[model samples]
Target: MKARSKRLMLVGGGVALLVAAVALVLSAFQQNLVFFHTPSEVAEGKAPTGKTFRVGGMVEDGSIKREADGLTVSFVITDTAKVIPVSYRGTLPDLFKEGKGAVVQGKLEADGTFRASEVLAKHDENYMPPEAAHAVEQASKAAATVSQ
Candidate 1:
């Protein structure tokens, strides 16, 4: 084969290999990626079964139930339009409370309940754990101040 033709063939092969590598890496990353959805969105068939995803919403009031074992807790998360039953088998964040926003990551069970492996309660802007309670307290003070 001519030298020029051989050089062109080598360059084309290099480009093809690079493209294949990128594609493989992207596929692996996509498989690990998880997305957040609201209770309403999940209820509308936005959450695919057996796939990992996150659901964020307010913890519905009077919906929390602790199992006899005390290690598992069940609650209903609501986004005003819909509610999703969630079960978690671990200690929850101290900020997790009723009528507060929270985000849970896990897969939806066949029984239509979300099996959350992790739960995160929303804090204030640029805040950390237990900030949700502080925020509520602050808001209560602000409201009282405004009424005074």
Candidate 2:
């Protein structure tokens, strides 16, 4: 083959490989991406099912229940306008408590319960996750609008 043809072939092969690598990286990122949602969004059926995602809100007062096994715990997370039931089977963070802000990473089950794989609590009394705070604010605004 001519030198020119060989050079063009090499360049085209390199470009193809580059494209394939980029595509692979993006695909992996997409698969690992976790989305954030609020209780209201989950109630409205906007959250994805059978996939990992995050839900942030306040743990409702008197909603925490622990099983006899001591490892399994159930709680309700709410944005004041709506609530989602979450079941977790593991040790909880020291900061986790009822009526405090929390973010749970898990999947929505068929029965409308959130099966949590990980739970994160707000680090300080005054600090709340941005997403959780936004969700609470939005929910309160929505409630006020409905009342008016």
Candidate 3:
């Protein structure tokens, strides 16, 4: 009714609308966000089911298997504490090899294998993606704690 009251109401409405817009944007962004999971997390069932995500870790030594077709390859990824099976049906990166770090983007299947759509392997023996490195560090810490 009063001019001052009208001005206050309008400001409050504007602020509320702004807050709502921000919340909506954040929610939409969250839906599209794909998080990187280590083999430990995947083994613990923390990976998203049916939705695409990233899994990064070292390719377990002696775990690489290639189909007769040559294009389909399966390997086990390990973060020391656990291992996740991944299958990719494409030419792997030149750097992809056993005991090397790799990051695969794809969906986790109901049977516990990650169906990779893309694979990025470390170019050097000392190199790893930052997220994969952090995950390995965390896994090592957890393994140490458990052993203690």
The prediction achieving the highest lDDT against the true structure is 2
Give lDDT tens digits, candidate 3, residues 25-133: 9999988898888888888888889998999988999999999999999998888889988999999999999988999999999999899999999988689999888
- The models' CA-based lDDT, in order, is 0.81, 0.98, 0.92
Residue-wise C-alpha lDDT for candidate 2, range 109-130, written one tens digit per residue: 9999999999999999899999
Q: How many Å off is the CA of 128 in candidate 2?
A: 0.5
**Positional deviation of residue 77's Cα in model 3 after best superposition, in angstroms:** 0.6
lDDT ranking from best candidate downward: 2, 3, 1
Candidate 1 Cα lDDT to native: 0.81
What is the number of backbone collisions in each predicted candidate, taken in the order shown?
Answer: 0, 0, 0
Candidate 3: TM-score? 0.78
Candidate 1 residues 1-148, lDDT tens each? Answer: 9999999999999999999999999999999899877676687787889999988766889999999998899999776556899999999988888887788899999899999999998665444334333333444565577679
Q: Any runs in candidate 3 off by more than 4 Å, and if so which?
A: 1-32
- List clashing residue pairs in candidate 2: none
> Which pairs clash in the backbone of model 3?
none
